[model samples]
Target: MRQRNFRVRSTVVAAVMVFSTVALAQPAAPLPATGNLQPETRAAQALPSLAPLVESVKSAVVNVEVVAKVSSSRGGMGDSPLDRFFGGGRGGSRENVRQGAGSGFIVDPKGLVLTNNHVVEDAVSISVKLDDGRSFPAEILGRDPLTDVAVIKLKGKVEGLPVVGLGDSDAVKVGDWVLAIGNPFGLASSVSLGILSAKARNIEAGPYDDFLQTDAAINPGNSGGPLFNMKGEVIGINTAIVGGGTGIGFSVPSNLVKALVPMLEKEGAVTRGYLGIQIQDLTADLGKALNLPVTEGAIINDVTSGSPSAKAGLKLDDVVVAIDGQKVGSANALTRVVALKRPGTVSTLTLYRNGNKQDLKVTLGTRPDIEGIGKRTPRETEESSKARVGVSLSDLDARTAQQAGFTRNEGGALITDVVPGSPAERADLAPGMLVVEANRKPIRSAEELAAAIKATPSGGTLLLRVLAPGANSRFLRALKVP
Candidate 1:
């Protein structure tokens, strides 16, 4: 199969897992004899011994039910001064709870199960129901929201349980037949068959979004179930499906979990190496401008000072071609490869610099909590208009300012909150930094900023160099605004 590295948005997972190369040659084997069935009946049998394989693994699969408790807030004036003094300004409170369900599979005999992080997050109570209808309380061991993977432990001993064998998802070809067995729509033990559809898709769900795409019929309740190959090995964990498609689905490769489970069991969390840099896909014009021979690998737009990349002497405008011999052609690929390394590990990066290949060794650092970035909904794009100078503005939040390495001081329209996923976030226009100018025009409030933006000609470019915290930093960005 094609060994491209790509991140997948949730639905994007179903699209990329289908890209596999042609099948390789292998010797065919003769069928084994059945003892009880008549000799003539062998010709009509669909599968020789699939029953034993299914029976062996079924005990490990489970149905997960979760309940989350939510508290409601109330605010109003108190009836009396004395009552207000005792109870404060807030009134009575009400408690509410929501129920959800999902699926999971036991990975160890001691009762450790694997499921999606989103499936059991914030749950106050979790229970796992086995195939024989026996249920046990489950406790979440740890979860990785960036990858949407979670591990949970169950009470009591359950020995001799058949564990699903993990297969190499990187080796699974597109035309290879696969099976998906899960509790779909709450239906017990639903089995669906399909072929690999694509691989290495960039759906934009998270940084490390690599997923296995399949045409297997997976639905709402199938979230953590296993996607098996013909040999009954778990190649992937069924995770998501396209909202409108019937047969399109996606799964987390079993290989990824194979690497994650041990770490979760030991540390109660997964630690990943980080190199602070902003990267972008290589475009034809950009490639030619950089004088690079090929439009492959990710281009470094900016590198944070004092970061691991900076310590390694990585520079802006450098193109990363590989990481420790692993080829990376996209930003998602770079993220995934970096995540595979430990925090203290030294990684060698092969980069294309001014049309020459050079190598640099970088001691990686642990990534900070990144669950909040990329969580905001994408902003709407507007028609571009040319206007006189003034800085564009948005609300000031701790997150916005921290990204720009600035302290939250002045409020009002913080620069660089516009949508459409561009370098505005890179322009260093962060929240808490007041927008002092637009097209060279002084802007005092939102009204002035709006007026300045409106004065620009429709379908033209606008520029604003704003003063932010620390040294007054200038901001530059281009957009079509209506």
Candidate 2:
């Protein structure tokens, strides 16, 4: 019996060896290389006539021409239709004319195009011209003024349309090769190539702004055009030009579009979560006072009453380290993360409180239409102006603050106003909130505040003991009086 078992085992081992030999002889083909150099070599070997991805995406680019019909109290002077008929007609009348030209690109085969909001703002008529010399009347899908992004749709039958692919803008590093495709000075199909000069640049174009700085020769007509990477993926939307800088331009990153496009397509506008908390970057002095390990994250300067932050128990001087899983490296990063989230969405905010990490759940609310909410009253303005600081001030008033979706009642003198190109604006004194004190002194009237400010010597450091009702309540801040 033992001899029979040994023969069977030997026979089984021999069969396995034969199978293994066959498997080794028939090896599978090697995986295609993902490296660009190897791929290029293979492509050259396969077909040397093939062009780069830019050639494929070029056909999708288009020119946008917008015409706005404006009705004004001040109308065209002389030769007015009313004046020619009645000989005493008023000059004020409504007239219509073409505004300007910009660039856009088709993102979908169904004729959906993306452009800048300011490009087609208030336009009664919008025409899109394709590279193939076809013209179509386009309708606006949505316009987000804050981000300056607009989506438009072509009405007629559009066929054989090429679409531009969106690339991850976050993946693009400085000094990466990029291409700008747009119509400058009505010149169609113009392309310029350059390197990405910078990324995550704050240009102060709007409240939620992080521009992609490039030296790709973008001009006036390049607004809303595509800024493509070497791989032919659209990484950004060309937006603005820098002052006195040759070949220096800016583009809105594609990540913004990834967040906004779906909302615009479905709802015609983007909705963002609002907390109404003013934040400031942590300074060296602030870090020292807070005893922080590092000067990172957003420090809550003030929280609006009844705001999402206040309801979430966010305290004054609490350093926000992360929001909804994304790290808040700066105030701008936090703002961008919040702006991407929809109102009514609950987000987990990680905060550093007394040198401890804690996460709080904050349900966001709808943001207010700040443009519609007018400035504060004369009395409110007069009172805030009295705050003896270097800044001009005004109040957010009970009504204005409420309408603006503020839930705090500790409202005092809101910095309703700031002079342009002034020290106040530069110091980031915005148009909202309550000011409780000036130069560490409690201020009951705007007159007293103004007196304190006037008494303060120029270039002196001033301390303010403030009561910010929301996230930052009873906070002490110091500012340099320029």
Candidate 3:
């Protein structure tokens, strides 16, 4: 036979396979004399199906339709009868209408539906269609953009509506069978089968991005749909998928939904606990530089002034090992634990500073809205000096300091250029970064920074605190000296 290769295209397609088993003739094995052992033969069992599970939960899955007003600057509208009748066809109204479709599921017998925020956000009118050909209008109850979860209530007398049973997403494991029901391409009651590929996935979709990854065939219209376990319980909400990729999709875990739904119903928004600290995961290189035994905690990069963390005396370079006795293995783990706590909660943090362990109680505050950093023009200067770490440094002038969101008194050695393929570049030290401190000592000028670098023994690590331009945050960088 001629050898040939086949490649599968990137699209969501259903596949089914069947196998037939045949018995072949074989010689019987001789039995032992006294204690003979016999092999047990069992009948072949039928493959499992999702038909009954789909039938029981399909009624709760709904199709969400949204209409919003859009502003267009186009000259005239097309030849629609309504548009011509409304605006005499000269320069039709600039206000146009847009429509979108998504999926949702009923979570309350009183007609309360759970869906994604992007589906009904900014919608002028919203309507929901059921699997039984019943359509009803819906109004947004509350939405949390941070988590991308929304709650909407159907209008009119919607008594005895079918509701989906919520499952414990924390109990789910990888490789567990899962089913997704949604409206794909406006086709209502569509179902897809897959298995849980992973958990606690952070796709950078949002700040709280603990998503359940699956290989389900979720499409554009599957957002806000329910991802069910074999027990016919909603374990996740279908949320995102990779563009131009097949069998890769993500869903919001149901536990997060369960936590936020009641709060959304009571309040219009969610208020998360704030630590007021910028942190990053510790790496082996950073651990070695910091003289730590293990790299399993989140290292504090910066503490906001007058914030909860600052008030609690949490300083820069402190490694948080645990929060409220819960081990924080990574930066994301710390973030999730802190954000799950309510405001005004006094939580104990186990942290290490200078290789010494300590505990501190911090009363978390309400998380504020994320502020945008402003940009500043970089000042050009001819005077520059070279540091041993392959970086060109310059004196930070008062004017340049103030322009870079720093006070005049906070003078430091500004990095003007970084040599490519050098230790400085490898440590992520770039131009436009201001080196404030070296080895726990303040650096006032380029000459001071050079002196600090030279004082360090050859082949030793130099820990430097630096601030990026256009932001009010500081971070530590560890560079190995030659």
Return the top candidate by TM-score.
3
Candidate 2, residue 69: how far the Cα is off, in Å: 2.6
Please give the RMSD to the true structure for each candidate, in Å.
21.8, 28.3, 25.1
Q: Global lDDT of each model? A: 0.66, 0.70, 0.76
TM of each candidate vs. truth:
0.63, 0.63, 0.64
Q: List model 3 lDDT by residue over 1-482, tens digit each.
A: 00000121111223435699765796667755433433331121234566888999999999988653334444554333212212212345444544567889999988889998767654555789998888887767777766778888887668768899889999999999999999776767889998999999988767788989999888767878999999999999887777654568889999999988977777756778999999999888988899988789999999999999999999999999999999988899899888878999999999989988899999999888783212111110111223244677888888767765565447788887775445577789998899999988999898898777767654578999998887678899998764
Question: What is the alpha-carbon lDDT of model 2 when measured against the actual structure?
Answer: 0.70
lDDT (Cα, tens digit) per residue for candidate 2, span 82-117: 121111222455332324677899999999999887
- How does model 2 score by TM-score? 0.63
Which residue pairs collide, candidate 3?
Answer: none
Poorest 10 consecutive residues of model 1 by lDDT? 377-386
Q: After superposition, how far is residue 352 of candidate 1 from its true place, in Å?
A: 1.0
